[model samples]
Target: MSRAVLWTKVVAGGLLMVVGGPAFVEYIRPSDEELRKRYNPDLQKRSAEQGERRAQEFDDYVNKLKHWSKSDKSIWYAAQEELDNKRAAIEAQRAQAKEETRTQREEMRKEMLGEK
Candidate 1:
Protein backbone atom coordinates (compact mmCIF):
# COMPACT_ATOMS: atom_id res chain seq x y z
CA MET A 1 0.00 0.00 0.00
CA SER A 2 1.05 3.64 -0.52
CA ARG A 3 2.39 5.58 2.51
CA ALA A 4 -0.75 7.73 2.97
CA VAL A 5 -3.06 4.70 2.67
CA LEU A 6 -0.93 2.73 5.13
CA TRP A 7 -1.04 5.63 7.55
CA THR A 8 -4.81 5.87 7.13
CA LYS A 9 -5.24 2.17 7.94
CA VAL A 10 -3.15 2.56 11.13
CA VAL A 11 -5.19 5.60 12.19
CA ALA A 12 -8.43 3.77 11.49
CA GLY A 13 -7.26 0.77 13.52
CA GLY A 14 -6.36 3.08 16.42
CA LEU A 15 -9.77 4.76 16.28
CA LEU A 16 -11.51 1.35 16.18
CA MET A 17 -9.60 0.22 19.26
CA VAL A 18 -10.41 3.43 21.10
CA VAL A 19 -14.12 3.20 20.35
CA GLY A 20 -14.82 -0.52 20.35
CA GLY A 21 -12.38 -1.91 22.89
CA PRO A 22 -14.16 -0.52 25.90
CA ALA A 23 -17.51 -1.55 24.52
CA PHE A 24 -16.34 -5.11 24.01
CA VAL A 25 -15.01 -5.25 27.54
CA GLU A 26 -18.23 -3.80 28.89
CA TYR A 27 -20.26 -6.35 27.01
CA ILE A 28 -18.28 -9.30 28.41
CA ARG A 29 -17.52 -8.17 31.96
CA PRO A 30 -20.41 -8.26 34.45
CA SER A 31 -20.21 -6.46 37.77
CA ASP A 32 -21.21 -8.28 40.96
CA GLU A 33 -24.29 -6.12 41.43
CA GLU A 34 -25.29 -6.66 37.82
CA LEU A 35 -25.03 -10.43 38.19
CA ARG A 36 -27.13 -10.35 41.33
CA LYS A 37 -29.69 -8.13 39.66
CA ARG A 38 -29.85 -10.52 36.72
CA TYR A 39 -30.65 -13.37 39.10
CA ASN A 40 -33.39 -11.44 40.92
CA PRO A 41 -36.25 -12.94 38.96
CA ASP A 42 -35.04 -16.46 39.67
CA LEU A 43 -34.74 -15.70 43.35
CA GLN A 44 -38.23 -14.24 43.47
CA LYS A 45 -39.67 -17.23 41.67
CA ARG A 46 -37.97 -19.62 44.11
CA SER A 47 -39.21 -17.64 47.09
CA ALA A 48 -42.76 -17.72 45.75
CA GLU A 49 -42.49 -21.46 45.19
CA GLN A 50 -41.26 -21.95 48.74
CA GLY A 51 -44.13 -19.87 50.09
CA GLU A 52 -46.63 -21.94 48.10
CA ARG A 53 -45.09 -25.18 49.37
CA ARG A 54 -45.34 -23.94 52.95
CA ALA A 55 -48.97 -22.94 52.48
CA GLN A 56 -49.81 -26.34 51.05
CA GLU A 57 -48.07 -28.09 53.90
CA PHE A 58 -50.02 -25.99 56.39
CA ASP A 59 -53.30 -26.83 54.65
CA ASP A 60 -52.52 -30.51 54.65
CA TYR A 61 -51.67 -30.41 58.36
CA VAL A 62 -54.90 -28.58 59.12
CA ASN A 63 -56.92 -31.09 57.13
CA LYS A 64 -55.28 -33.97 58.98
CA LEU A 65 -56.10 -32.37 62.33
CA LYS A 66 -59.71 -31.88 61.30
CA HIS A 67 -60.00 -35.48 60.19
CA TRP A 68 -58.46 -36.70 63.41
CA SER A 69 -60.96 -34.73 65.51
CA LYS A 70 -63.98 -36.37 63.89
CA SER A 71 -63.84 -39.62 65.86
CA ASP A 72 -64.94 -41.15 69.24
CA LYS A 73 -63.85 -39.40 72.44
CA SER A 74 -61.12 -41.95 73.12
CA ILE A 75 -60.14 -41.83 69.53
CA TRP A 76 -60.25 -38.05 69.69
CA TYR A 77 -57.93 -38.10 72.70
CA ALA A 78 -55.60 -40.41 70.88
CA ALA A 79 -55.89 -38.17 67.86
CA GLN A 80 -55.04 -35.20 70.07
CA GLU A 81 -51.80 -36.89 71.06
CA GLU A 82 -51.15 -37.64 67.43
CA LEU A 83 -52.02 -34.06 66.61
CA ASP A 84 -49.53 -32.86 69.17
CA ASN A 85 -46.92 -35.09 67.60
CA LYS A 86 -47.76 -33.74 64.20
CA ARG A 87 -47.53 -30.21 65.49
CA ALA A 88 -44.16 -30.97 66.97
CA ALA A 89 -43.10 -32.51 63.68
CA ILE A 90 -44.25 -29.44 61.84
CA GLU A 91 -42.39 -27.22 64.25
CA ALA A 92 -39.26 -29.23 63.68
CA GLN A 93 -39.74 -28.99 59.97
CA ARG A 94 -40.19 -25.24 60.23
CA ALA A 95 -36.98 -24.96 62.19
CA GLN A 96 -35.20 -27.04 59.62
CA ALA A 97 -36.60 -24.96 56.79
CA LYS A 98 -35.48 -21.78 58.52
CA GLU A 99 -32.02 -23.20 58.96
CA GLU A 100 -31.91 -24.19 55.32
CA THR A 101 -32.97 -20.71 54.26
CA ARG A 102 -30.37 -19.15 56.50
CA THR A 103 -27.71 -21.39 55.04
CA GLN A 104 -28.78 -20.49 51.53
CA ARG A 105 -28.68 -16.80 52.36
CA GLU A 106 -25.24 -17.14 53.86
CA GLU A 107 -23.95 -19.01 50.84
CA MET A 108 -25.35 -16.40 48.50
CA ARG A 109 -23.85 -13.62 50.57
CA LYS A 110 -20.44 -15.24 50.45
CA GLU A 111 -20.71 -15.79 46.71
CA MET A 112 -22.21 -12.37 46.14
CA LEU A 113 -24.90 -14.11 44.18
CA GLY A 114 -28.14 -12.90 45.76
CA GLU A 115 -30.66 -10.24 44.77
CA LYS A 116 -30.81 -8.75 48.26
Candidate 2:
Protein backbone atom coordinates (compact mmCIF):
# COMPACT_ATOMS: atom_id res chain seq x y z
CA MET A 1 0.00 0.00 0.00
CA SER A 2 1.03 3.62 -0.56
CA ARG A 3 2.48 5.48 2.48
CA ALA A 4 -0.29 8.09 2.15
CA VAL A 5 -2.95 5.40 2.38
CA LEU A 6 -1.14 3.76 5.30
CA TRP A 7 -0.90 7.07 7.19
CA THR A 8 -4.57 7.77 6.48
CA LYS A 9 -5.57 4.44 8.04
CA VAL A 10 -3.34 5.08 11.08
CA VAL A 11 -4.83 8.53 11.66
CA ALA A 12 -8.37 7.20 11.28
CA GLY A 13 -7.67 4.38 13.72
CA GLY A 14 -6.19 6.80 16.25
CA LEU A 15 -9.15 9.13 15.94
CA LEU A 16 -11.53 6.23 16.40
CA MET A 17 -9.60 5.18 19.49
CA VAL A 18 -9.71 8.71 20.90
CA VAL A 19 -13.41 9.39 20.26
CA GLY A 20 -15.12 6.01 19.83
CA GLY A 21 -13.32 4.53 22.82
CA PRO A 22 -14.91 7.04 25.17
CA ALA A 23 -18.34 6.70 23.53
CA PHE A 24 -18.16 2.95 23.89
CA VAL A 25 -17.06 3.19 27.53
CA GLU A 26 -19.80 5.72 28.27
CA TYR A 27 -22.47 3.43 26.82
CA ILE A 28 -21.09 0.31 28.51
CA ARG A 29 -20.56 1.85 31.96
CA PRO A 30 -23.34 4.21 32.88
CA SER A 31 -22.91 7.19 35.23
CA ASP A 32 -23.96 6.87 38.91
CA GLU A 33 -27.01 9.07 38.37
CA GLU A 34 -28.05 7.00 35.35
CA LEU A 35 -27.71 3.81 37.41
CA ARG A 36 -29.73 5.34 40.24
CA LYS A 37 -32.51 6.31 37.80
CA ARG A 38 -32.74 2.76 36.45
CA TYR A 39 -33.64 1.23 39.83
CA ASN A 40 -36.81 2.00 41.83
CA PRO A 41 -36.40 4.86 44.25
CA ASP A 42 -37.70 2.66 47.03
CA LEU A 43 -35.07 0.02 46.22
CA GLN A 44 -32.30 2.62 46.16
CA LYS A 45 -33.39 4.05 49.47
CA ARG A 46 -33.66 0.58 51.00
CA SER A 47 -30.27 -0.45 49.68
CA ALA A 48 -28.66 2.71 51.07
CA GLU A 49 -30.32 2.20 54.42
CA GLN A 50 -29.29 -1.44 54.46
CA GLY A 51 -25.70 -0.50 53.65
CA GLU A 52 -25.67 2.05 56.47
CA ARG A 53 -27.03 -0.51 58.90
CA ARG A 54 -24.42 -3.04 57.84
CA ALA A 55 -21.64 -0.48 58.23
CA GLN A 56 -22.88 0.48 61.67
CA GLU A 57 -23.07 -3.18 62.68
CA PHE A 58 -19.53 -3.73 61.47
CA ASP A 59 -18.29 -0.74 63.46
CA ASP A 60 -20.07 -1.95 66.54
CA TYR A 61 -18.55 -5.39 66.16
CA VAL A 62 -15.07 -3.92 65.81
CA ASN A 63 -15.55 -1.77 68.87
CA LYS A 64 -16.81 -4.71 70.86
CA LEU A 65 -13.85 -6.79 69.75
CA LYS A 66 -11.52 -4.09 70.95
CA HIS A 67 -13.26 -3.92 74.28
CA TRP A 68 -13.29 -7.67 74.68
CA SER A 69 -9.59 -7.83 73.82
CA LYS A 70 -8.79 -5.45 76.66
CA SER A 71 -11.29 -6.81 79.19
CA ASP A 72 -11.53 -10.26 80.83
CA LYS A 73 -14.86 -11.12 79.19
CA SER A 74 -14.96 -14.28 77.05
CA ILE A 75 -15.59 -13.77 73.35
CA TRP A 76 -18.55 -16.14 73.32
CA TYR A 77 -20.24 -14.38 76.21
CA ALA A 78 -19.65 -10.96 74.72
CA ALA A 79 -20.93 -12.11 71.34
CA GLN A 80 -24.07 -13.59 72.89
CA GLU A 81 -24.75 -10.45 74.84
CA GLU A 82 -24.34 -8.34 71.70
CA LEU A 83 -26.79 -10.60 69.85
CA ASP A 84 -29.29 -10.38 72.72
CA ASN A 85 -29.04 -6.61 72.70
CA LYS A 86 -29.62 -6.54 68.96
CA ARG A 87 -32.68 -8.78 69.31
CA ALA A 88 -34.07 -6.57 72.05
CA ALA A 89 -33.56 -3.48 69.92
CA ILE A 90 -35.31 -5.13 66.99
CA GLU A 91 -38.21 -6.18 69.23
CA ALA A 92 -38.51 -2.65 70.57
CA GLN A 93 -38.61 -1.23 67.06
CA ARG A 94 -41.29 -3.71 66.02
CA ALA A 95 -43.32 -2.90 69.11
CA GLN A 96 -43.11 0.82 68.40
CA ALA A 97 -44.22 0.35 64.80
CA LYS A 98 -47.07 -1.92 65.83
CA GLU A 99 -48.25 0.61 68.38
CA GLU A 100 -48.12 3.40 65.83
CA THR A 101 -50.15 1.35 63.37
CA ARG A 102 -52.77 0.63 66.04
CA THR A 103 -52.95 4.30 66.92
CA GLN A 104 -53.48 5.25 63.27
CA ARG A 105 -56.21 2.63 62.86
CA GLU A 106 -57.99 3.89 65.95
CA GLU A 107 -57.84 7.46 64.68
CA MET A 108 -59.18 6.41 61.29
CA ARG A 109 -61.96 4.42 62.88
CA LYS A 110 -62.98 7.36 65.01
CA GLU A 111 -63.08 9.64 61.95
CA MET A 112 -65.10 7.18 59.89
CA LEU A 113 -67.53 6.17 62.65
CA GLY A 114 -67.99 9.80 63.70
CA GLU A 115 -67.32 8.85 67.29
CA LYS A 116 -65.27 10.73 69.92
Candidate 3:
Protein backbone atom coordinates (compact mmCIF):
# COMPACT_ATOMS: atom_id res chain seq x y z
CA MET A 1 0.00 0.00 0.00
CA SER A 2 1.04 3.59 -0.61
CA ARG A 3 2.26 5.53 2.45
CA ALA A 4 -0.70 7.96 2.24
CA VAL A 5 -3.28 5.14 2.13
CA LEU A 6 -1.57 3.30 4.97
CA TRP A 7 -1.48 6.43 7.15
CA THR A 8 -5.12 7.22 6.37
CA LYS A 9 -6.26 3.72 7.38
CA VAL A 10 -4.35 3.89 10.66
CA VAL A 11 -5.79 7.31 11.53
CA ALA A 12 -9.34 6.19 10.69
CA GLY A 13 -9.02 3.02 12.81
CA GLY A 14 -7.74 5.07 15.80
CA LEU A 15 -10.63 7.56 15.57
CA LEU A 16 -13.21 4.77 15.26
CA MET A 17 -11.95 3.10 18.46
CA VAL A 18 -11.81 6.40 20.44
CA VAL A 19 -15.47 7.12 19.52
CA GLY A 20 -16.96 3.60 19.34
CA GLY A 21 -15.39 2.16 22.54
CA PRO A 22 -17.54 4.22 24.89
CA ALA A 23 -20.61 3.81 22.70
CA PHE A 24 -20.28 0.04 22.75
CA VAL A 25 -19.90 0.06 26.57
CA GLU A 26 -22.93 2.33 26.97
CA TYR A 27 -25.04 0.05 24.78
CA ILE A 28 -24.06 -3.00 26.85
CA ARG A 29 -24.44 -1.58 30.37
CA PRO A 30 -27.81 -0.95 32.04
CA SER A 31 -28.77 2.61 33.06
CA ASP A 32 -29.33 3.58 36.71
CA GLU A 33 -33.13 3.73 36.34
CA GLU A 34 -33.29 0.31 34.71
CA LEU A 35 -31.06 -1.17 37.40
CA ARG A 36 -33.27 0.34 40.10
CA LYS A 37 -36.38 -1.09 38.48
CA ARG A 38 -34.78 -4.53 38.46
CA TYR A 39 -33.42 -4.19 42.02
CA ASN A 40 -34.06 -6.91 44.60
CA PRO A 41 -35.80 -5.73 47.78
CA ASP A 42 -33.43 -7.54 50.15
CA LEU A 43 -30.35 -6.05 48.45
CA GLN A 44 -31.88 -2.58 48.46
CA LYS A 45 -32.69 -2.83 52.15
CA ARG A 46 -29.13 -3.91 52.99
CA SER A 47 -27.62 -1.08 50.93
CA ALA A 48 -29.83 1.51 52.66
CA GLU A 49 -28.99 0.10 56.08
CA GLN A 50 -25.28 0.29 55.27
CA GLY A 51 -25.67 3.92 54.16
CA GLU A 52 -27.43 4.83 57.42
CA ARG A 53 -24.75 3.13 59.48
CA ARG A 54 -21.99 5.01 57.64
CA ALA A 55 -23.83 8.33 58.15
CA GLN A 56 -24.21 7.64 61.87
CA GLU A 57 -20.54 6.76 62.17
CA PHE A 58 -19.57 10.01 60.45
CA ASP A 59 -21.78 12.01 62.83
CA ASP A 60 -20.21 10.33 65.83
CA TYR A 61 -16.72 11.11 64.50
CA VAL A 62 -17.56 14.80 64.01
CA ASN A 63 -19.13 15.05 67.46
CA LYS A 64 -16.11 13.45 69.08
CA LEU A 65 -13.84 15.97 67.35
CA LYS A 66 -15.98 18.87 68.57
CA HIS A 67 -15.85 17.55 72.11
CA TRP A 68 -12.07 17.34 71.96
CA SER A 69 -11.75 21.00 70.91
CA LYS A 70 -12.36 22.72 74.27
CA SER A 71 -10.48 25.88 73.22
CA ASP A 72 -11.52 28.28 70.46
CA LYS A 73 -8.30 27.64 68.52
CA SER A 74 -7.78 25.42 65.45
CA ILE A 75 -8.69 21.83 66.36
CA TRP A 76 -5.75 20.19 64.52
CA TYR A 77 -3.27 22.67 65.98
CA ALA A 78 -4.67 22.10 69.47
CA ALA A 79 -4.36 18.37 69.13
CA GLN A 80 -0.76 18.72 67.92
CA GLU A 81 0.03 20.98 70.86
CA GLU A 82 -1.40 18.46 73.28
CA LEU A 83 0.75 15.75 71.70
CA ASP A 84 3.85 17.96 71.97
CA ASN A 85 3.09 18.75 75.63
CA LYS A 86 2.86 15.08 76.46
CA ARG A 87 6.16 14.37 74.73
CA ALA A 88 7.86 17.24 76.59
CA ALA A 89 6.56 15.99 79.94
CA ILE A 90 7.91 12.52 79.20
CA GLU A 91 11.35 13.90 78.24
CA ALA A 92 11.49 16.04 81.38
CA GLN A 93 10.80 13.04 83.52
CA ARG A 94 13.53 11.07 81.76
CA ALA A 95 16.06 13.86 82.29
CA GLN A 96 15.19 14.15 85.98
CA ALA A 97 15.73 10.41 86.46
CA LYS A 98 19.08 10.58 84.69
CA GLU A 99 20.27 13.44 86.90
CA GLU A 100 19.22 11.58 90.04
CA THR A 101 21.15 8.48 88.91
CA ARG A 102 24.28 10.54 88.29
CA THR A 103 24.14 12.05 91.76
CA GLN A 104 23.67 8.64 93.34
CA ARG A 105 26.64 7.23 91.41
CA GLU A 106 28.89 10.11 92.57
CA GLU A 107 27.86 9.54 96.19
CA MET A 108 28.70 5.86 95.94
CA ARG A 109 32.18 6.53 94.49
CA LYS A 110 33.01 9.07 97.23
CA GLU A 111 31.90 6.67 99.93
CA MET A 112 34.01 3.81 98.47
CA LEU A 113 37.18 5.99 98.50
CA GLY A 114 36.42 7.41 101.97
CA GLU A 115 36.52 10.91 100.51
CA LYS A 116 33.16 11.85 102.14
Candidate 4:
Protein backbone atom coordinates (compact mmCIF):
# COMPACT_ATOMS: atom_id res chain seq x y z
CA MET A 1 0.00 0.00 0.00
CA SER A 2 1.03 3.60 -0.53
CA ARG A 3 2.46 5.47 2.49
CA ALA A 4 -0.63 7.68 2.59
CA VAL A 5 -2.98 4.70 2.61
CA LEU A 6 -0.90 2.95 5.28
CA TRP A 7 -0.98 6.03 7.47
CA THR A 8 -4.73 6.38 6.90
CA LYS A 9 -5.32 2.76 8.02
CA VAL A 10 -3.20 3.34 11.11
CA VAL A 11 -5.11 6.46 12.04
CA ALA A 12 -8.44 4.71 11.50
CA GLY A 13 -7.38 1.77 13.65
CA GLY A 14 -6.19 4.08 16.41
CA LEU A 15 -9.46 5.99 16.29
CA LEU A 16 -11.45 2.82 16.46
CA MET A 17 -9.49 1.70 19.53
CA VAL A 18 -9.80 5.02 21.22
CA VAL A 19 -13.56 5.15 20.77
CA GLY A 20 -14.33 1.44 21.10
CA GLY A 21 -12.22 0.52 24.07
CA PRO A 22 -14.39 2.23 26.66
CA ALA A 23 -17.61 1.09 24.98
CA PHE A 24 -16.35 -2.45 24.92
CA VAL A 25 -15.37 -2.27 28.57
CA GLU A 26 -18.76 -0.90 29.50
CA TYR A 27 -20.50 -3.57 27.50
CA ILE A 28 -18.62 -6.45 29.09
CA ARG A 29 -18.26 -5.17 32.64
CA PRO A 30 -20.85 -6.25 35.19
CA SER A 31 -23.07 -3.59 36.68
CA ASP A 32 -22.73 -2.73 40.38
CA GLU A 33 -25.95 -4.56 41.18
CA GLU A 34 -24.79 -7.61 39.31
CA LEU A 35 -21.50 -7.57 41.18
CA ARG A 36 -23.26 -7.16 44.54
CA LYS A 37 -25.75 -9.92 43.86
CA ARG A 38 -23.00 -12.16 42.57
CA TYR A 39 -20.88 -11.62 45.66
CA ASN A 40 -23.60 -11.28 48.33
CA PRO A 41 -26.67 -13.16 47.25
CA ASP A 42 -29.54 -14.37 49.47
CA LEU A 43 -28.83 -11.62 51.98
CA GLN A 44 -32.35 -11.55 53.41
CA LYS A 45 -32.70 -15.28 53.37
CA ARG A 46 -29.43 -15.75 55.14
CA SER A 47 -30.31 -13.16 57.73
CA ALA A 48 -33.66 -14.81 58.34
CA GLU A 49 -31.98 -18.14 58.76
CA GLN A 50 -29.55 -16.66 61.25
CA GLY A 51 -32.37 -15.07 63.19
CA GLU A 52 -34.22 -18.36 63.36
CA ARG A 53 -31.14 -20.12 64.65
CA ARG A 54 -30.65 -17.47 67.31
CA ALA A 55 -34.28 -17.75 68.35
CA GLN A 56 -33.89 -21.48 68.70
CA GLU A 57 -30.82 -20.99 70.85
CA PHE A 58 -32.67 -18.54 73.06
CA ASP A 59 -35.51 -20.97 73.44
CA ASP A 60 -33.09 -23.69 74.50
CA TYR A 61 -31.51 -21.40 77.08
CA VAL A 62 -34.90 -20.49 78.47
CA ASN A 63 -35.83 -24.13 78.79
CA LYS A 64 -32.63 -24.87 80.64
CA LEU A 65 -33.11 -21.85 82.88
CA LYS A 66 -36.57 -23.10 83.87
CA HIS A 67 -35.21 -26.45 84.94
CA TRP A 68 -32.31 -25.07 86.97
CA SER A 69 -32.33 -24.74 90.78
CA LYS A 70 -32.49 -21.42 92.63
CA SER A 71 -28.81 -21.79 93.39
CA ASP A 72 -28.01 -22.17 89.69
CA LYS A 73 -30.31 -19.34 88.64
CA SER A 74 -27.47 -16.83 88.76
CA ILE A 75 -25.42 -18.76 86.25
CA TRP A 76 -28.44 -19.26 84.04
CA TYR A 77 -29.23 -15.57 84.24
CA ALA A 78 -25.72 -14.73 83.14
CA ALA A 79 -26.03 -17.16 80.28
CA GLN A 80 -29.32 -15.59 79.31
CA GLU A 81 -27.70 -12.16 79.36
CA GLU A 82 -24.95 -13.38 77.10
CA LEU A 83 -27.53 -14.74 74.70
CA ASP A 84 -29.25 -11.37 74.71
CA ASN A 85 -26.02 -9.66 73.83
CA LYS A 86 -25.41 -12.10 71.03
CA ARG A 87 -28.93 -11.56 69.72
CA ALA A 88 -28.40 -7.81 69.78
CA ALA A 89 -25.11 -8.14 67.94
CA ILE A 90 -26.71 -10.31 65.30
CA GLU A 91 -29.50 -7.79 64.82
CA ALA A 92 -27.02 -4.99 64.43
CA GLN A 93 -25.10 -7.00 61.87
CA ARG A 94 -28.29 -7.72 59.93
CA ALA A 95 -29.28 -4.08 59.96
CA GLN A 96 -25.87 -3.00 58.75
CA ALA A 97 -25.90 -5.55 55.98
CA LYS A 98 -29.36 -4.42 54.90
CA GLU A 99 -28.29 -0.80 54.92
CA GLU A 100 -25.23 -1.57 52.84
CA THR A 101 -27.32 -3.50 50.33
CA ARG A 102 -29.84 -0.71 50.18
CA THR A 103 -27.15 1.86 49.59
CA GLN A 104 -25.59 -0.23 46.86
CA ARG A 105 -28.94 -0.76 45.13
CA GLU A 106 -29.67 2.94 45.31
CA GLU A 107 -26.32 3.79 43.81
CA MET A 108 -26.87 1.27 41.04
CA ARG A 109 -30.28 2.71 40.30
CA LYS A 110 -28.83 6.18 40.12
CA GLU A 111 -26.15 5.01 37.75
CA MET A 112 -28.74 3.36 35.50
CA LEU A 113 -30.84 6.52 35.58
CA GLY A 114 -27.82 8.59 34.51
CA GLU A 115 -27.81 10.52 37.74
CA LYS A 116 -24.52 11.66 39.19
Q: Output the better candidate (1/3) by TM-score.
A: 3
Error of 3 at 114 (Å): 0.8
Stronger candidate by TM-score (1 vs 2):
2
Query: Candidate 4 — which residues are off by over 4 angstroms?
Result: 1-73
Better of 1 and 3 by lDDT: 3
**TM-score of candidate 3 versus the correct structure, residues matched by position:** 0.42
Considering lDDT, where higher is better, how would the candidates rank from best to worst? 2, 3, 1, 4
Candidate 2 segments exceeding 4 Å error? 1-62
Residue pairs in collision within model 1:
none
Of the candidates shown, which would achieve the greatest TM-score relative to the real structure? 2
Q: Which stretches of candidate 1 lie over 4 Å from their true place?
A: 1-73, 113-116
lDDT of 4 by residue, 1-116 (tens): 79999999999999999999999999999997676566555875686579789999999877766655444458767677768999999999999999999999999999989965
Residue-level lDDT tens digits of model 3 in 14-98: 9899998999999999997787678799977787679889999999878857866877878888778878999999999999999
State the lDDT of candidate 2 residue by residue for 1-116, as single tens digits.
99999999999999999999999998899788788788898989987789889999999889988876776778878778878999999999999999999999999999989964
Clashing pairs in 4: none
Window of ten residues with lowest summed lDDT in model 2: 67-76
Tell me the tens digit of each residue's lDDT in model 1 across 19-105.
889999988999977765777798967866797899999999889777766855565686778879999999999999999999999
